[model samples]
Target: MSADGAGGVSRSPVERYTDRMVAALQRLEASDDPNLTFSRLIDVMGRSSHRLLILLFTLLNMLPGPPGFGGTIAWTTFGIALAMIFGWPIRLPALIGDRKLPLSLLIKLSERVAVAARYAARFSRPRLKWLTGAAATIPFGIFVMAISVVMTIPIPFINAIPNVGLCIMSFSMLNRDGVGLLAGLVVCLLGLTVAAAALFGAFELASTAIESIR
Candidate 1:
């Protein structure tokens, strides 16, 4: 799982992060510790790398998992978003942080993410720096927070929509790709619109049912 850095040549952010992710997963796989907690996983993944964390979690949310997995990851992402907004170090509460993860399942999921990240790195490079720079962090955080909330809704097939957008934004930020960032923003907006419409429709349906019953 050790990533070859092409003999230490300069690489795009996506490439660099992909390497880090691969290496981290490798370490987890080789660790002697029987119990791998979420907090440890975060530490192994580099706690200071907020963009990477967001990217990883967003990707995880897109994958199939146990029941309620989507909501759990969405809330974790929400916490990360808040940390980004407040400029605080990322930390999970014990309830989540202490929770044990199935290492085998994580490795499997991470392998998929690594492959996709490598493919994305082929076309991504640092461009439109301002959009991915510090000035945009708060806005991006807020946007991600909104998307994460939408993802928490129990609406079937709804979580995947904004998750794709978030994953793009995260990848864009990691690679400093402003064009990609804008594209991600558009997708997020579209997702949010769909989520809102669905929620409104549900509310209306419930109200009509109540009236009929009365």
Candidate 2:
């Protein structure tokens, strides 16, 4: 599908980019022509937004775990995450709840996203640093949401928030303060864990109080 310059129009959550990329690969080598070159593929993806890119990466992180266990939900989440960040439609059919879905395909697609993100790194470093650094609010918001999720678990939920490391690292990366980021990560990690413990304790205390009253 053709994408506009403002950014590619999003593909349906149904489409898996890995399959599309694989097809494109086949067509490129259909003839006796050399396989699609690296530079060629890079040219096709182009520069993408740091915000969208980070969001995609975050969602992808949700995979390989409890968050993305089901079929259509997993791949669709993957496809839509990519589309949101890269700004293009994927168009893969939904395989809702299909347990036999090909995870290797999704893994492969995840790798591609990383590769594209790296390419973005070449020229987008300055921009990424500037945007993220100046936008502390971004990380703060992510931190808040992450905290909310962490608090939902049975015990110590406050501390085990996924991406706590990544989110903390983001602020460091944003501020262009390597040392600060590193420290922030450690602090947030511990702080979250401690917060989780506190929450669990509080819950236990409440449950105990109710039991005593009952």
Instruction: Return the top candidate by TM-score.
Output: 1
Candidate that would win on lDDT: 1
Local accuracy of candidate 2 as per-residue lDDT tens digits, 43-71: 22232323222333343343554533422
lDDT of each: 0.82, 0.42
Off by over 4 Å in 1: 1-10
lDDT of 2: 0.42
Q: Which pairs of residues have clashing backbones in candidate 1?
A: none
RMSD of each: 2.8, 14.2
Can you give the TM-score per candidate against the true fold?
A: 0.90, 0.29
Model 1 lDDT tens row, 95-208: 878867777777777777678777776777678999999999999998888888888888888666678888898999988999899888888888888888888999999999
